[model samples]
Target chain A: MTKEELKIKIEDILPAATFDETGEWLNILIEAKAWYGFAKQIRSSRELEFDYLFCLTCIDWKTHLTMVYHFTSTYRRHTIVIKSKLDRNNPEIESVAAIWRTAEFHEREVYELFGVKFLNHPDMRKLLLTDDWSGGFPLRKDFEDPINMIRL
Target chain B: MIEEVGTTTEGDLIINIGPQHPSTHGVLHLVITLNGETIKNVEPHLGYIHRSIEKMCESLTYRQFIYVTSRMDYLSAHINNHGCALCVEKGLQIEVPPRAQVIRVLMDELTRLASHQLWWGAMGMDVGALTPFFHAFREREMINEIMEETCGARLTMNYMVPGGVMFDLHPNFQHRVKKFIEFFKSKIDEYHELLTGNMIFVNRMKGVGFLSKEDAISYGCTGPTARGSGVICDIRKLYPYEVYSQISFEEVIETGGDCLSRYLVRMEEMRQSLSIIEQLIDNIPEGDFQAKTKAVLKLPKGEFYSRVETARGEFGVYIISEGGTTPYRIKFRSPGFSNLSALNHMAKRSKIGDLIAIMGTLDLVIPDIDR
Candidate 1:
C-alpha cells in the first residue's frame, strides 16, 4: 500500500491519531496511553499485520521524548511509522518487546541513551552504556556534559 | 561481603576468550561461563574498536560519511557505501543515471565476491584448514585490484556517493572484471575439490551449530545465516532497489540450518553474484554519473530506514532528521548483532572446538557487532 492510503486507513481506525505525511514514510503520532493497544492492533489486525518491527529508537526532543517504531509487513510489503510522545520529565511507555522480539535490544538502548523507561521491559538494564554512567540522558537536546563535551 | 561471596559459589569456570586472540577476529572478548566444556553462559564484551562513527557522522557532510561506513564492515565496504548512498539519494529524491546504477550493482557484486572469498578462507582457517585460505585469497586479490584502480582504495573504497558513484567506470574495470570472471570459473572447481567434498571439512561442519528456522527468525538472523535455515528474507528481492529489480539471481536457500548449511549458502551465493556481474557487464549505459544536488544536505524533520542484504545478513540504517545537516539520531541495525545473539543458543551444547567452528560459520567481524 502507498503511504497516503496507509495514513488514511490509520486515521480511520484511530481517529485521534495525528498524521505527518510529508516524509517518505507514513508517520502516525499516537498518545502514550494508547501506544500498547495500538501496537497490538497493528500487529494482529488482518489489514495491517505488521509482523516485522525492523527498527525501534527514541528521539530526545528536549520538551518531550518521541518513541519511533518502524514497522513493515513481510506479507503485504507495506511500511508504517508509529510515533508516541512521552513526558520529558519522566519518559515511560509500555514495552513492545513482547510483541516483536527484535524490540528487546533497541528498547534497552533507548532506555539508556534517552532515559525513556519501558514499563514492562523484562530486562531494562544498560545494553551499550556503562553502569557508571550517571549523566542525564545523553541524547536529549538539553543534555550537557562537561566531561563528554556533549552540547546540544 | 564475605558472607555474600561464600553464598555465591562460582559454579562455572569464567574464561575470557579474547581481547586479542587471533580466532576471535578483532578484539572480541567473549566471557564464557562454562561447566566442563559446556557453555553455561556467554557474555560478549565489545567496544574495543568503537570509533563512534555514528556520533562522528554528525560532523561530516553526506559525501564524507560514506567513507566512515566503510570501516564498519571493511570486507563488504561496497555494500555499506551502496546503503549510505541510497539513503542520501532517497533523502534528496534524485534519480541515479542508468549507467551509474549498473556500475553500482557490479561493484556490489564484486564486493560480495570479495567478502565471501575472505569468509571462505577465514572460515577454513577457523576449522583448522590453512591451504584453502591461500586459495581463496588468490581469487580475492583480483577483485581488490579492480576496486583499487577505480575507487582508489582496496578495502575501504568509498567509491559510492549520493546520486551516483564517485567517478565513471575505470577504463580497465570491464576488462579486469571479465578476466577475474574467467579466472574464477576455472578455479571454482578447486573449492569443491579441496573444501566442500573433503571428509574432515564435512565432519566439522555438518551437524554443528544447528539453528532452527523459527529460532532464526525470532533472533532476526539474516543473509546466509537465515537462508541456511530456509528463510526467504533477502532485501534485494523483497524491497527491490537499484537495478536489482531488472536482474535475475537465485536467493540461495538451504534447509540444513547447521554450520555446513551456512557454509554451503555462502559458497552458492558467491556463484550467484558472479553470474549477476557477468550478465550486466557489457550492457553498461552511457549517461551522467552523478545527479545534481545541493552542496549542503539538510534532511527535513523525518525518519528514514534502509535495509540492505550484507554478506552476513540484513544491515539496517535508521536515521532521524530534525531539519539539520547532522542527524538527530542514527542507529545501525547490524546483521552481526542478531547473528551474535544466536551464539548462546547455537554454542551451548557444543564442545569447545565446535564453538570455534560455529563462530567461524557465523562470519562475524567484531567491529560490526560492537557498532
Candidate 2:
C-alpha cells in the first residue's frame, strides 16, 4: 500500500494523531497515552501488519525525548515511522516488546543509553553498559565525561 | 571464565562459554543453562568490544562516518559503507552514475562471496572438519587480492563515498573478477563433495537449532538467517537498492529452519553471488565512477533511511539530518544484533553440541553484533 492509503487507514483508527510531511516515510505523531494501543493496531491490523520493527530509538532533543519507531510490513512491503514525545524530566512509555520480539533488546538499549523508562519491560537492565556504570545516560545531549580518569 | 559451573534450578547445569573462545567467534559470551545435554537458555553477554560506534558517529560528519561502519561488519564492510552512503545520498538527492551503480553492485557481490567463503570454512571447522577451513580461505584470498587491487584495503574497504565510489575500478578489475568467478565456480562442487554431502556433518546440523517462520519474524531476523527459515527478508529482492533491481538473481530460500538449512542457504548463496558477478563482470557501463559533489556535504533537515542486503542480512542506515554536515542522529539497524537475540529461541532444548552448529550457521561476526 502507498503512504497516502496507509495514512488514511491510520487516520480512521487514530483521529487525533497528527503527521509531519517532511520526511521520506510517513511520519505519524501520536500521544504517549495512545501510543501503546495505536502501536498494537499498527502490528495486528490486516491492512497495516507492521510485523517488522526494524528500528526503535530515542532522540534526545534536550527539552524532551522523541521516541522514533521504524516499522515495515514484511507482507505489504510498506514502511512508516512513528514518533512520540515524552517529558524530559520523567520520560516513560508503554513497552511494545510484547508485540514485536525485536523491540525487547532495542528497548533495553534505549533505556540504558537514553534513560527512557520502558514500562513493563521484562528485563529492564543495562544492555551494553555494566551494572555499576554511573555515567548519566551517555547518549543524552547533556552527558559529559572527563578526558582522563584516575580510577578504573 | 566459568567461576560457577554448577547445577542451577531443577538440576540444569549452567555453563558459560567464552567471552574468548575460538568457535564462539569474536568476544561473544554465551551463558548456557543446560539440563544434562539439552540447552534450556542461552543468554548472550555483549558489549565487550563495543566502542559505542553510534555515540562516536554523532560527532563525525556524514562523509567520515561511513568508515566507522566498515569496522562494524568487517567481513561485509563494503556493503555496510554502501548502506550509509545510500542513506546520505537519499537525503542529499544525488544521482549515482550508472557505472558507479554497477561497480557498487559488483563489489557488493564480491564481498558477499568472500564472507560466505570464510563462513563455510569457519563453520566446517566448528563442526570438527578442519580441512575445508584451509580450502575455503584458498578461494577467499583471491577475492581479498582483488579488493586490495582496487580499494587498496583487504578487509575493511571504505571504497564507497557519498555521491559515488572513492575511485574508479582498477585497470584489471574486470579481468581479475572474471578469472576469480571461473576459478571459484569449479571449486563449489568440491565444496559439496567435501562437506555438504558428508553424513557426519549432516547429522550434526540437520534438525538442530530449529527456528520456525513465526519465530523468525518475531525476532526480526534478516538475510540468510531468516531466509533459511523460508522467510522472504532479502532486501535485494524486497526493496532493491542501486542496480539490484536490474540484476536477475534468486532470493535463495530454504524451509528447513535448522542448522543444515541455514548452512545450505549460504552455500547456495555463494553460487548465486558467482552468477551475479558473472552477469555484470563483462557489462560494466562507461561513465564517471564518482559523481560531482561539494567538498562539504550537508543533508537538508529530514529523516532518511536506506537498507542493503549484506552477507549476513539486512543492514539499514537511518539518518536524521538537521541541515548539518554532521548527522543529528544515526542509527544502524544491524542484522547480527537481532539475529543473535533469537539464539536462545533456536537453541532451546537442543543438545550442547548442536549449539555450535546453530551459532555457526548464523555466521555472526562479533563486532557487528556488538556495534
Per-residue alpha-carbon lDDT of model 1 for B32-66, expressed as tens digits?
76777787766665566765566666656667777
Tens-place lDDT per residue, model 2, A54-119, is 888999888899999989888898989999999999999999989998889889889988999999
How much is B168 displaced in model 2, in angstroms?
A: 1.3
DockQ for candidate 1, please give it: 0.35
Docking class of 2: medium
Query: Each predicted complex: what DockQ?
Result: 0.35, 0.51
TM-scores for all predictions: 0.91, 0.97
Model 1 misses residue B337 by how many Å?
Answer: 1.9
Leading candidate by TM-score: 2
What local lDDT does model 2 show for residue B327?
Answer: 85
